[model samples]
Target: MLAPPSASPRSVPGLRVPGPRTEPAPGRGARAAYWARLLPLLAALACATRLPSFRWPLWSPDEGYLAVQARMLADGGELYETVVDRKPPLVPWLYAGAFTLFGDDSLLPLKLLALAAQLLTAVLLVSLARRRWGDGAGRTAGVLYLLISVGLNPEDAQAATFEVFMLPCTAAAMWCADRRRWGAAGAAVACAFLAKQTGGAVLLPVGWLLWRGGAARRDTGRLACGLGLPVLAAALLTTPTGFLFWTVTGSGAYASFTGSELHVLVRGLINAALLAAACAGILPPVVRVLRIARTGAAELWLWLASSVAAVLLGFHFFGHYYLQLMPPLALLGAAALQILPRERTVRALVASGCACAVFLAWGLLAPRPELAHATRLAQAVRADTGPRDRVLFWGMHPETYWLADRPPASRYLTAGLLTNYSGGRDGPQVGEKYAVEGAWPVFRREMRRDPPAVVVDDSRGKPFAPDRVPSLRRILSVGYAPVARVEGAVVYVRVGR
Candidate 1:
């Protein structure tokens, strides 16, 4: 995570606590006031770190799905029926609720909520790490979290911010387990699970804690009731449609765990390794921050990386999918912050790591200048689009939907320009098989249907193909004609004739 840029004076004299080793404090009361002021300061800093230039960094195509689902829910779909997917009702449900309450999601209020939640996430991680380690470690870990966390785009961050709220509850419960608050910990674990699948992983961490602490089975059982039962209840109550979606449709899209594809495993491991190398580079600074967990920080790396491997290799490898691993990495980094030696070598390593992290993140995340033309065309569509117009795009740029202020539904997925919606039974293997078949006739028929379609496409990345371009051509050839070409992006109008 990126360290929220500090607006407060840097290196304040009496406020800087250097872990348990520092004995230069004047009085406990003064220190208490110091800390009291500091917490809000950190909170403000965290909020600011995430709030930079929030005019929309870059929108992912998937964001439209979220926007669409949220819009549908706000329009008054009930419970399970409201959310389109079965993965979990938590995030989409939250978006729906937010949209319903606000009535319009385009304004500042929704943006503020996302920003607030992200800041809260940073603060919570710092507090939990501090409780386990010390001020020094927490501060260091907090900075690292701030650094790495900035890697995600504003929209991506906003989409997953719901889980940030749940992470702290789980972390707090685990922190409690360190003190033998078994029942409380169990309940916390359950709550997190109810929040997201990552929450379910808390059970592993907590169960490990129970075994490590030598707690009795009866105690563990009590904790599970408090923590786990509600998750099960939430799952059951929200079943039927949500569950059915998962079993039938969602499985086709998700199932990362059961995925037999070779890249599934490779991608997961590569992501984990990148994370591991990242943590190792920052270990020295983190060691100086938290003195309490001096020995355990290394162990944390293993557990954290293992968890990342589990998630990355599982249902999907979407960049935001790595979020669950962030908290632990932050904690370990915080613990390491308390024990750094002031040697030149250590400082140099930390600085180098910081530089590498920034560059890598920039390369991975920086806006492709090429996307500008596509965005410009999106502006055109936004201006010309009539109220009833359902804008359709058949290109790499799905985010254009959000910028165009259109309801997301069929806007992003121009698949119909390329396939048959009424084609198959939606079995587990159907989507892959269909794509493999790479037939264009299905799409021609879909485009030929009632609503009429406006298709947008560009071939910058491949100009030929990246994810699937052979198909890109077939669609480009039959149903679409070039309407506008900005930079490298070509917007085509789908004339069903």
Candidate 2:
């Protein structure tokens, strides 16, 4: 068995820590028996915690937008051109695969994909912790991951967001780094990056470990080769200009600071508080790291720090961004608990379980304003239009498109292009400062080419009235008229249809 550096096992009476520093590996039968019991329990826990997601029609507009793009891709549309988003290609492709495998309307397949990723991440943490500490610590780490993963804001916790998918790859990279498998670590890092750009931060700690361990030249060379393979494959699958524009150039504008200092500060403070409250069960381990365990577990500390950088990468501080920190925190907390008395360990486990249960209940019972409105809008659209007809939503509600089973008329699904309304930021900025140049012209061109059968204005006139947009107003006046009002949204149908 392995243990924390320079720390001997304490002779605690009831604590179940590692026996010795360098024991022989466990027998294959013992390993199999351990997994045979643990895997089922972890699966059950994951299912129980994620139960609320299946009840929701949509988690958030982000996933809804991704689903819409995925649907378009399934119908032979190209990404970053015919259908565009600032996210990388892998997640969209995953969603597309889910749509293909289990009809576009079935969300169960997508939910299963996310659950598999979460479970795989927990299993990897178990393996890593078991190797470093002991079986008890390993089990604790896996359980803790499942518990805290759902102890978050409902949208983030229930939705299969990019963070949820990227975690397994991120944890795998860390596990490879711990085992000194530099090349495999690099490969896993690449996969994580393909899932989300924030995953690139995994390189920081991996590089630190490599240099600190004084790796051989061949090891570094192999790592570079592993990192390049997946990127090369991605390049072949996508147009260079399209990929760069959406993932880099377009994202740069989204990341730019547009809100007031006070507003940003307050949002950051609120998110910080939320993270603390949700993950409070793991606080003791964090405190231990800050006070005493830093030098002994420096790599874990580096991992935690790098994750913080990734979480705050775009400076948006959304709840899902905090998922990046959970893996390392779980491992560190498990290691800390390994030496604690049985009473303390039990107390921590109970607290984590309670947090998970409370959050799960809240997420299940919470009323999502967007989901209700989108459902109404979708019902109206379906009643008014055929299944094959194109519908355009002129607001932040991309979920309407997915819900109605209608294809979007433009690459820009939401009004972000026209309104310059960046989510997780302050307001719909004035004067189109943050808006993409030529996006409006593109939207106009697409509308002319496709000419949606129905157009839904869901903005509710808070930021701007649809009639206030001269181009849209002219188009509607020429060819369309309002047919129904569903909730606050006005549904319009083409004249003479």
| Tens digits of lDDT, candidate 1, 291-355 | 33224443355447555654644444554566667777677655543444435224534663474
Q: Please give the lDDT score at residue 89 for candidate 1.
A: 61
- Candidate 1 residue-wise lDDT at 3: 26
Task: Give the candidate number with the greatest lDDT.
Answer: 2
Model 1, position 168, has a per-residue lDDT of 63
Weakest ten-residue segment in model 2 by summed lDDT: 288-297
lDDT of 1 at 353: 48
**Local accuracy by lDDT, each model:** 0.53, 0.80
- What lDDT is obtained when candidate 2 is compared to the true structure? 0.80
